[model samples]
Target: MAEPQPYESALDAIPGAHPYPRSSRYHDAEVGIHTQPDGTAVRYVKRRLLPPLGEADEDIATHTVSSGERPDHLGQRCFGDPAAWWRIADANPVLDPRELTAEPGEEIALPDGFPGGGGRFGR
Candidate 1:
């Protein structure tokens, strides 16, 4: 198996709140596959199956960053799920949420509300 890539970990009140940015791709797939020469009569190259990324998301709300805040905190405040901080990160595509949070007034865009009904949304 190929070595795993490291990603930034999210800190929060809950466990497993942070998911690996790109996870289990290598170990979850096959590699070093050898095929018979005369390929047409033998096996074929491998291609990984990918899940659909889904449709575009509309903006639900905009937030003004406040001092000493973290992505997880904003996530909990906005979506009731601290783990959902990635949603905030994904929407803005910023390199660092900590910088945004420390900026103390930077406007951040929040993704659209969750499609399904209930208190749950994009967590």
Candidate 2:
């Protein structure tokens, strides 16, 4: 069985609510190599912050946040995958998740009606 994640994932109730090192967003970047004095090259892989996906002409739905919500939770509820939380952020584009769902009665845009954020997400 899959563990139940909160709608507002950044909520304090969830254990380890924050992603471990901001999740796998850095996997896209190439690793850097450092030359050592002993003629050996040490390779280091650092996590990279990616540019946010922009909003486009896509069908969407509204979700009323009731405190303790996270993008992953909404994504899971609406798109069936927690990873799709970024979609919520993209639709709303709040600099911080806290601001996205700050109040208990705040409303955020939830993508629905198609796959992959309503399909054909433009760059």
Candidate 3:
């Protein structure tokens, strides 16, 4: 019925708000803006490039997918934290996390130890 006010996400209300944790793949992504012909400003996050699969291959460990295995659970089993599942995704070629354990008896590579301690993460 009326013009909308400028959009400021709830997270923007908090000073130094960071939606992604340091361990997240998006932690270092940059924010970008685009302008329409009407001059309205649109903000968005820039595309994030995935690290090459081999980056996480250092000190690699393998786990055979069992029936009903989940990525979060696999992350916990491999890296001690379910939230670190992306680490597993980064080490493999699959674009979807679910594909990591979609088939029973499939082998997946995992980077051992802290993300950046020796692995290529935290770059």
TM-score of model 1 relative to the true fold?
Answer: 0.45
Winning candidate number (lDDT): 3
Clashes of 3: 0
Give candidate 2 misplaced runs (Cα > 4 Å): 1-58, 113-115, 119-123
Indicate the worst ten consecutive residues by lDDT in candidate 2. Answer: 114-123
Off by over 4 Å in 1: 1-58, 113-123
Rank order by TM-score, top first?
A: 3, 2, 1
Residue-wise C-alpha lDDT for candidate 1, range 1-123, written one tens digit per residue: 133334322332235443222222222233434556766444233554432233334434567877888988877776676766766665564678666476788887666642211122334
Clashes of each: 0, 5, 0
Q: What tens-digit string does per-residue lDDT give for candidate 3 at 25-88? A: 6766887789989999987779987655565455677778889989998767665667878878
What is the lDDT of every predicted structure here?
0.52, 0.56, 0.69
Model 3: CA > 4 A from native: 1-16, 112-123
TM-scores, all candidates, are 0.45, 0.46, 0.66
TM-score winner: 3
Which 10 consecutive residues of model 3 have the lowest summed lDDT? 114-123
Query: Clashing residue pairs in candidate 3, if any?
Result: none
